[model samples]
Target chain A: TQLLEQSPQFLSIQEGENLTVYCNSSSVFSSLQWYRQEPGEGPVLLVTVVTGGEVKKLKRLTFQFGDARKDSSLHITAAQTGDTGLYLCAGPNNAGNMLTFGGGTRLMVKP
Target chain B: NAGVTQTPKFRVLKTGQSMTLLCAQDMNHEYMYWYRQDPGMGLRLIHYSVGEGTTAKGEVPDGYNVSRLKKQNFLLGLESAAPSQTSVYFCATGSIRRQPQHFGDGTRLSIL
Candidate 1:
């Protein structure tokens, strides 16, 4: 079974629309991270939430870490075509060494 | 700075063939990891090294091996390639266990 689960494996929306992606797990994490990967490219770090119930915002992107540290969410406002890519969520293992990744959510914003 | 790089962006191999994927990092990181990305399967760790001369298995370690002879280089080897091993592989390097990892574009491999 996958330790982390991501919802809406695929999402396509209009340029001005808004969307949110979720990552859930039964296990608690020391920290959770979000990444975005473009076609033919590797994933780039977007944000990292270390505290439970912490919320961070990067320009138009907002990220939230569950109070229990067992889940997280990424919400994008005024989505643009440039926001198109695969969004991935990961959390460091209980040992705080290796990371376990979610399945991933692909987002496409058509202009 | 070429945070991390993988050689031969793409490759095709036949079953039973052996090959090695090289990952180099300029970040001078102590930890390096190898992961395979497959459609609908996400990224599964194949192997990882905490430092030079040390290696550990990840989520998926069967049919694959790794080595970290130097601080800046990590290599993944496939003794006998199989169709099941076909997928896009990624290499990552990090300064600390909790720090964000930098990734290489990826190596697209296909075993016929």
Candidate 2:
């Protein structure tokens, strides 16, 4: 089974601080996606990185895919309370549609 | 658009009982998935259907079953409930090809 390991399982930061979460794996992926899920709700797609070494920015959030296609990262700048949630990274499984998710990084941003 | 909707926002079942979680999508997407999330374990795929009348097992499909009789609806059933099965379940659907999926508010199932 393809497994994605995410580091910093838990994070707590004050507002305006910066934080980064990493997802690494030994298997190459066709695409990698990052999602943020709030309490009581299903996850929402934050970004999808398909190309190796590609970078995409969504406002204050930035996502990067590894050149080898085996890792990804999510960075949040000037964090806000709204950024508090469970951040997950996933890649398409062998079936192509099913995703194998990382354990997750729970972030709590304090004011 | 209602996106995706899962019936019975919350349910509590006893051991050996059975129940089905209904997931309906109005977006007309062809791919649908069911996932379970534990406190610190992230999300694990239980079952999925790529289209109507098709079903496939995911990474953790033990003690779970799924059916997609229609393009817009996927059903997940538990033949016999166990405490280990208790978790927050989410349903998601996407378009014909690879696309960002839209999700539904999850169902919180508790087995006592």
Please give each candidate's TM-score.
0.96, 0.95
Residue-level lDDT of model 1, residues A1-111, one tens digit each, is 339999999999999999999999999888899999999998898999999999999999999999999999999999999999999999888776578899999999998
| lDDT string, candidate 2, B1-112, tens digits | 1689999899999999999999999998888989999987888888888789999888789999999998989999999999999999999888734343788999999999
Error of 1 at B6 (Å): 0.5
lDDT of 2 by residue, A1-111 (tens): 889999899999999999999999999999998999988888998889999999999999999999999999999999999999999998987767678889999999999
- Candidate number achieving the greatest DockQ relative to the actual structure: 1
Runs with alpha carbons beyond 4 Å of true place in candidate 1: B98-100
Q: Clash number for every model? A: 0, 0
lDDT of 1 at B27: 85
The true-versus-predicted C-alpha distance at residue A2 of model 2, in Å, is 1.4
